[model samples]
Target: MNILVISGGPRKHGRTAIAARFIERTYGFHTVDLSIVDMPMYTGEEDQSSNPFVKSLRQSVLDADAVLLLSPEYHSAMSGALKNTLDFLSSTQFLYKSVGLIAMAGGGKGGINCLNNMRTVMRGVYANAIPRQLVLDPSVFDYDRDGLNREAAEQVDGLVEELKMYARIAKEVKEQQLI
Candidate 1:
């Protein structure tokens, strides 16, 4: 499947980026690291469709068979950058698309809230977010800073498999509906 992983951390070398890179390297998935991209905050008052970054972001979502949102917990919620990026998109870009959620918690205890928040937004955009989500805490990196430990890697593997399965099922359903 053409999985698009969006790294929504503010820091380029943060935990979210590490997870994104690991997924890309292990699964050959495409990644959009938001920390390096200068995506203007979505104000809804301006038409950013013409903006190159916004256009690219929109196109990326449109081209993906599935999306994996990677975010770091911040004050019990997702980063503002991620929320703004999501605001630039609509149901047209995500409807029926399989989406996987992963949250990195700096405090080792706050990632679940971030995942919950992301799930709510995915619902609003009509994405078929898989039920198997992940919340990686500090413990996940205790054995490996650049990648997930053995246990966390297994969890991510399961989530990715579920995402791929759902993406295939959704694609088949859509094709059948057209016929």
Candidate 2:
């Protein structure tokens, strides 16, 4: 399956990027690091049809069978950059798509709030976001080795598998026009 992973951290090499890269390395999924891209705030007042970045972002979501959104917890929620990115999309890009969420915290807590916020946004965009989400903290990482601990790694695997399973079901139902 073609899985698109979006690293919603504002820093290119932040914890969210680390987790996205880990998943890419482990499962061979493609990743889009939003920090490197120029994502203008979505005002929805101007015509964005010619904006290449916006088009690419929408196309990426449209092409993926599943998506994973990784964000760093910011003040008990997801970063502004991530929220802005989501604003560029709507049900046209996400409806019926299976999505997975991962929230990272610099400290050893507060990732759950970020996950919950993202889930609510996914629902608004009509994404079939799976319930098996991840809340990661500093303790789960091993920056020296550029990887997560064994337990955390296993949890990531399960989350990815869950996304794939849900994506497959969604695909089948869509193909059969079962809604």
Candidate 3:
């Protein structure tokens, strides 16, 4: 299925991206990392209707069957880049769309706040968000010659399973007649 995984963490290669990539690979789903999409902060002054970035991003979201929001906790919330990305899209962009949320953190809250906050935001946009998502503890890291820790390697399988299940069900139901 066409899946768009928006990475909400500032660090492009951080744990959140890694986890997202793992899930993408597991499902063999097509994903677009919004972190790499590159758009200036919304100013309202810019006509999103005409903005090429907004246009392309919106096109991708519209084309995708589901969206995977991978976020990190920032001030008890999801990252601003992510929030802004969603904000830029607004209700006009996401209505009737399916979304899945994933969050990660090094410690403490482990990004639950990020997940919850993004979920709330999704609600505001009238998105049909998937109920299941992955929350990863950074300690799962098994740092190797490449990077990350052993725990990261361990968590990969389970997280991938969750993503795959969601994708399968969503793809089937989305393709089938709604009951």
Candidate 4:
């Protein structure tokens, strides 16, 4: 399955990216990182007239079978950049897609609020968001080269099993309707 991971931290070496990369590896699956680490900020209308950057970002979201958003808690929620990007991505880009969310914050609460807000947005557009969530506390892990964290790595395997199960059930239910 194709999975797109969006990391919402400005820092390239932060916990959110680390966890996302860990999940990315579990899939042996095709993936893209949508954080500031890669894509430029959204300018949906103007940039769309010429920019390959926005075009490619929109395509990636459309192609993925599942979306994984790894976000940090900013004043108890997701950062503006992440929110703005999604605001622009509503409709055909994100509609009816499966989504998985993970949030990590160093203090106060984890980014659960961020994920929930995102879930509401995704649901508004008819995306099938995965209900299981991962909330990371203290939000940082040691990455031994190659950006892989041991604990996060282990959890990804478990998450994949859930994704696979859901995919199977969804497929069966869909096929039954065709009969």
Candidate 5:
């Protein structure tokens, strides 16, 4: 499947990017790091011709069978940069796509809020967010900076599996409609 993973943290080497890298390595999914993507703040007046980066990002979302969104919790929610990037996408861009969410937080409690907030936003975009989610504490990666903790890794595996399953179903349904 053509899966797209978006890392929403400003720090390229932060936990959010690390999780996205793991997903890319394990699944061979394409990843877009917001830190590296030259996206200006979405101002609701953007045209495809005016902003190449936003246009390409929108096309990536439209082309993906499934998407994995990794965000670092900031102030009990997703970072402003991620939210702004998402603002550039309309509901049609994400219609019926399967989405997996991973929320990393400085404190474990904030991750849950971030996940819930992401779910609501995904719904607005008409994306089917898998019920399985990963809520992580940054401290969990302290011991193994190169990898996730065992339990966190297992949860990420489950989330990926769920996204694959849902993406398959969505594709089948779309095919049937086309037929």
Candidate 6:
């Protein structure tokens, strides 16, 4: 499946980015680091007709069978970059697509809030968020070597499995509708 892994942290080499890289290496999923993307703050009045970055970002979502959103909790919520990227998308872009959320916090205390917030936002865009989510603590991830500990690796495995299953179901339903 064409899964898009979005690294939502602004730091190019943060824990979130590391985790996203793990996913990319393991599953060969396409990874987009928001730090490198030239996405401007959504003002709701910008001309997207000529914006190559926006167009490319939108097309990435359109091409993906599922999306894995990785974020670092910032003040009990997702990073502003993640939220802004979502703001650029609409229901049509996300409808029926599977969304898996992974959130990281320093003490493992704030990721739940970020996951919950992301769930709500995904719902608003008509995406199906898998029930399984990964709440990561940096200590559990070997950021120095860019790997996950045993426990974190298991959780990621489950999340990826769930996302693929849901994506398959969504694709089947879409195909059925075309018949």
Candidate 1 residue-pair clash tally: 0
CA deviation > 4 Å runs, candidate 3? 142-179
lDDT (10s digit) by residue, model 5, range 128-169: 999888887876574355667777788888888999999999
Stronger candidate by TM-score (4 vs 5): 5
Per-model lDDT: 0.90, 0.91, 0.71, 0.68, 0.85, 0.89
| Model 3 residue 27 lDDT score | 61
Per-model TM-score, in order, reads 0.95, 0.95, 0.77, 0.79, 0.93, 0.95
How many clashes does the backbone of model 3 have? 10
Clash totals in order:
0, 0, 10, 0, 0, 0
In candidate 5, stretches whose alpha carbon ends up further than 4 angstroms from where it belongs are 142-145
Q: Write the per-residue lDDT of candidate 2 for residues 49-99, one digit (tens) a residue.
A: 568999998999999999999999998899899999999999999998999
Poorest 10 consecutive residues of model 5 by lDDT?
A: 138-147
The alpha-carbon lDDT assigned to residue 150 of candidate 3 equals 52
Residues 1-179, model 6: lDDT tens digits: 89999899999878888898888988899998998888888887769635787788788998999999999988888999999999989887899899999998876475999999899999999999999998888778886679888888888999999999999999999999999
Give the least accurate 10-residue stretch of model 3, judged by summed lDDT: 141-150
> Model 2, 67: alpha-carbon shift in Å?
0.7
